[model samples]
Target: MSDQTSMISARGLRKSFVQRSRKGPGIEFEAVRGIDVDVRRGVAFGFLGPNGAGKSSTMRMICCVSPVSGGELRIFGLDPATHGPEIRSRIGVCPQEDTLDNELNVWENLYVYGRYFGLPRDVVRDRIDELLDFVQLTEKAQAKVDDLSGGMKRRLTIARSLINKPEILILDEPTTGLDPQARHVIWDRLFRLKQQGVTLVLTTHYMDEAEQLADRLVVMDKGVIVAEGSPRELIEQYSTREVAEIRFGVGENEALAPKVEDLAERVEVLPDRLLLYTDDGERALQDVLGRGLRPETTLVRRATLEDVFLRLTGRSLAD
Candidate 1:
């Protein structure tokens, strides 16, 4: 089997939403500028960006929820514009916000969604029971959605999306409001899905989340892509193998920013701390100390996806 027959392929995708003017001149907003992406079967792909950077918009197009204005988007080699319903039938979607029915219980949510997809009653019933167990929500099957916790609701929503046993699963902001333990629960299940060779595409403003799940990813900024690669590759190419963050006691990070700009391969100074990027963090720290630069606090760590993100874009991912 050749690689060109990938599960998802997009080329030069462009999307702009028109804004109607009430008074003065209003203009159109191009949420997604021209971009291309591909995802093969049995791999997890991610879109990582700040808010309004077009991650969700791109996901919508892939799921056939929102149409693109120009360029190409194909799911399973089927054009989203011409084969939306057919494409949607093969994919499951979890929106950024919970869209679960407040009227339905946890199990009923999955059953009802399956039935809406025209699945046979027995099939829907069987899938619901299985999915409830898969999501670890068996105990809450009969509980009302309003009575469930935030993490429980998120899991239920995800379980609901899986009723059809779809070929592709698209998740937007999958763990937005969950605590650490809850997030781990969701991550564990997602990892199990990956082991089963489920093709997953997810959008997240969290850099750590992307690093955790994405086999390959694209980072978007200002409605355009800035970088695309596997987490380790992007970090190695765009940033250093290690980074040191130093916080000054008296002056702002900018006060010493210029002095240490050339100390590392790359430097970014914010209000709180200044980042020093270098292939060898220990050597960089020694040089800083040798230069008589004293910081109130210092932390040296391995270069991560967040470091690469901050280096490419001026803004933080969570911001």
Candidate 2:
């Protein structure tokens, strides 16, 4: 889509930082190399990569918290440099860390954040109740922030971010430390927000989370975007239909890799298992056994976003 139609647009966007070195003059470290991006209105766009892959830097620029070092960027058709305050007012940010004040209660946390947006007490109080209920934190509204569970704190943070009823919501590792159940609750809330026509932008380490939440995503590595597509498009482009996982005991995977290498389209020998990429995992396993090789255990599964990342980056997404 053209820049006019896109909610967020970038052309050769870049960000860099000056690093002070002990030996000599400070060096320049480019966190986000020049890249192009477009985030359409009301769609969930995700930035994904391993640690220090420019995802955070890009998000910072999008949120108008960090100035661009080079290239052009526009949020809501306004340059962040000139309209930083306006852009910030139109968007909500949920950072990776829980920034809630432990001294405040759950309701108080949202109350204070709304007031920061210059909202009137009556409006802020009303919005606080709506947000708390939206994030399923209404029952815990009177409880101390420090006493809330990790998931509750995360939900409260999300509620606080929405105090101004922003059109765009940016989340950084939204469910980093939450359990599966908690993560699902967070996902449900986010899904509802998206349904309400809020544009969702996020960065995540969990491949499954990306699959569930992102309509389109980009994979960045070493300060550049390496891949961009829907999760299924990415998997289809980078991986096979199925993956056959075979464990030949702890140290035997590498040694036995060659024996099954020709049985599938490709073979990846991890330290603990051999992943055979092929269209038919069952046939590949039978081929292994036909060769008189008996694996300690075997599992056949469909190719996923993680497999695509492994193929593109030569490592797990979390690594």
Candidate 3:
């Protein structure tokens, strides 16, 4: 892509950390291996991976808070090593943890963050009002930060990140530990941001979340990218169109796998379930039943990014 169209670009990017051993010299741990990434402007790009997959390390590097160990990284066509301040000024970051001051009220929290960006007093006040309204926190403007719910705190953090009207927003595990209702609310707000043409970079382990928001994504494992593509493309390339989830009695799924191996293109035996990957899940179910095998329950559903991750990594996305 052209430089004008790419928000962030990394070629052979690498990051390492020096760790001191208990009884020996310090050792180096390579957190992010050589990886290439191109984040286009005005698109929501995601990094999907399990914990310790180097997603956070990459995010730190992109935010210019952590120095690059090797290779090249350019944000908005500017090298972070020399232009860290300039790059950070135009980018907003919502880290994995909430960093709001609990002692401060909701409005104060946003107002203080705006001032930290060196915004004028009048401008900061105006922006705080707009952001509170945008995040649906107008009613809680005067409430202490500690009094808000998890969802409310998260919304406040998002609002704070936008005080500078950043060109790009980077979120790490945006909805890590929220309830279903709260998660959807955050998703709706993020969708609105995308519609407004803001470039978003997010890291998440939830396959459903990645499918909902990511225009394109890279799956990382063991500090390396294993696969990269749009959600539908990855699903089509790595998984069947439908998945047949069958559960026999306890400890019976493994024994039944051999009998129904021919029912689908692939069969994966789990502790409590057997997944049959096929184009026609209903036909596969019928075949299983035709063989005089009865399952306690059966569900035929459209394949998802979770299936793709499992197929590629031999592990569940949540793991």
Candidate 3 residue-wise lDDT, 100-158, digit = tens: 99999999999989998898999999999999999999999999999999999999999
Ranking by TM-score: 3, 2, 1
Candidate 1, 249-294: lDDT as tens digits: 7566788888888889888887789999988888888888888999
TM per candidate comes to 0.96, 0.96, 0.97
What 10-residue stretch in candidate 2 is worst by lDDT? 1-10
Question: Per-prediction RMSD in angstroms?
Answer: 1.7, 1.8, 1.5
Candidate 1 residue 227 C-alpha distance from true site, Å? 1.0
Total backbone collisions for each predicted model: 0, 0, 0
Better by lDDT, candidate 3 or 1: 3
User: lDDT of all predictions, in order shown?
Assistant: 0.88, 0.91, 0.94
User: Which parts of model 3 are misplaced by more than 4 Å?
Assistant: 1-4
lDDT against true structure, model 3: 0.94
How many collisions between residues are there in candidate 1?
0
Off by over 4 Å in 2: 1-4
Number of the top TM-score candidate: 3
Which residue pairs overlap in candidate 1's backbone? none
